[model samples]
Target: MGLLAGCWSAAATAQALDAPNVVVIGPNLVTSGQPTAQALARLSQQGFEAVIYLAPSSVPDAVGTEPEVVAQQGLEFIHLPVPFGSPTEGHFESFAAALQRLKGRKVLVHCQVNMRASTMVFLYRVIFEKESPASAWESVTRVWSPEGPWKRLALSQMVKHGIKFDPF
Candidate 1:
């Protein structure tokens, strides 16, 4: 009976970890794809205190009224608007600053498909949180492998921050 109970507990934990469009990166942070209003409500129910959006409002899939929806759900909303074609260091800095300020708070950082969110979170974890580069890269790659300009941006930023990781 004890062994059966342990299996049940593990299954339950796996289910919680498999929330659609959401990835639990650490104790205080979660990354996600574009979330719907229902998803935001669910996040609130799950105790996420803040939501940081990296995608711009002009994006076709973005929820234009997300700020109001997030406010209604009682979650703080921040928009940094990093372009998919060309993410800048300034954008990274803003994201880092916001993440730093929100340290210890339950925060969700999201982009259109978790690409930007995961990369930004990877950099934050490696540089600011002093996490291992390989470990942080694992989380980032789990979403989407960065490429082209995005790849360049990530690599350059990592170099600037003195983070070293072998290309996977």
Candidate 2:
């Protein structure tokens, strides 16, 4: 019975490891595709009151136009210039601070592809929110970022912060 229980638990946890929705990290929060007017509208309809953007250095025309449009929609916007694989200490501090500030507020945080977005979210969930490692990982996978160096950077951030979860 004990062995069966352990196996079942492992399986259950593994199944939960599957990704969650691409949008909406939580019920009131969302992170959509590169800043499109339509995507911003969708997030607004979902009730996100604040938006945190981590976009590529070279923002596209459609994406370039989003911040002003989103702001005009009456949602608060905070933009971070986060190029992949180059997360600075200030970037992590600001990101973590933003996460903390937005706690319980209707917020949406996103990067162009959400690879950096998801990575930051995972670290926030684990370190600040005190979520279980499994739960944090679940959130990470749910909005798994595309293949990039940001993933490695995120793991390094965790190690630098002295979190118990091993990146390896």
Candidate 3:
């Protein structure tokens, strides 16, 4: 009875939460939804060797503590607070660098709501992960609409990185 209840609870959790794209592109590349202690723990259990944060500065405490916890779990943690629409070359470059560093290691990159985080992940995959433009656009559109300023910036940055996905 207890085992059945646990299974039911897990199923409910999966259904209740927003279904962010959780994909395993390679031996170590994985993506998922928002960040939390339990989420990090699950990532750790699933071989996520690093946690990359792109959350807003206002909610630093909630997302910032993930690094410490990840360390304790014997995984690395890296935080990159990439505000929407103003992502610098340095930020993008550093993020790219981080992704390179975590190559061959399971990495879970996320934000508070996973919108910005997903965009960043899509850009990284498109540019650095060698994912095709079609795949990248599909991956990003799964979580973000191609409308609005934030999406505009995201598409433009992809172009800057030599990804030729159509904006509309």
Candidate 4:
């Protein structure tokens, strides 16, 4: 039964790696929801080279010790600490800069439940990667359909980047 259990565990890992909320934006880029310490260790074991955390440590669900854990696991950790309702262009810029610097490394970008990560990744793809807005939007919507301030933040960044979106 150990073999069977191992198979089931592998299958579960694969499924989690393929979950819609774990958005693989590129060969080297992934965006996911907040992950526990165990999940961080697993990600390191699975060859993720770096983690960019967009959620503040003060966030209700944040694991405050994640940075230290990630470092102990030998994965680079970058913390940007975006607020839930008010993500700024500077935040996006920093994230984009980190991504550019880490190009070719397998990196995970995560925020609380992926809301912030997905939106930022969408903007990054459309603005910097030259991906079509429609395609980027598809990826964003797959994880979550942003509304209210989140939607406004996305739209504002799109405009700043000169990527037009129809409001209909």
- Which order, best to worst by TM-score? 1, 4, 3, 2
Ranking by lDDT: 1, 4, 3, 2
69-142 per-residue lDDT for model 3 (tens digits): 77888988787887665666677678888889888876767666566666667778778768886766665665
Tens digit of per-residue lDDT, candidate 1, span 20-76: 356667556888788775676566666678889999989877877889878887888
In model 2, the clashing pairs are 19-142, 20-142, 115-145
Model 2: how far residue 61 lies from native, Å:
6.8
Using TM-score as the measure, which candidate wins? Answer: 1
lDDT of each prediction vs. the true structure?
0.80, 0.64, 0.65, 0.79
For candidate 4, what is the total of clashing residue pairs?
0
Clashing pairs in 4: none
Question: TM-scores, in order shown?
Answer: 0.86, 0.74, 0.74, 0.84
Residue 89 shift from truth in candidate 4, angstroms: 1.2
Task: Indicate whether candidate 3 or candidate 4 has the larger TM-score.
Answer: 4
Model 1's alpha-carbon lDDT is 0.80
lDDT by residue (1-168, candidate 4, tens digit) is: 487775665455445553236766655677888876668767776778999999898887787888888899888999998988887888889989998888889888998788899888888888888898887787677677888777887888888878888432
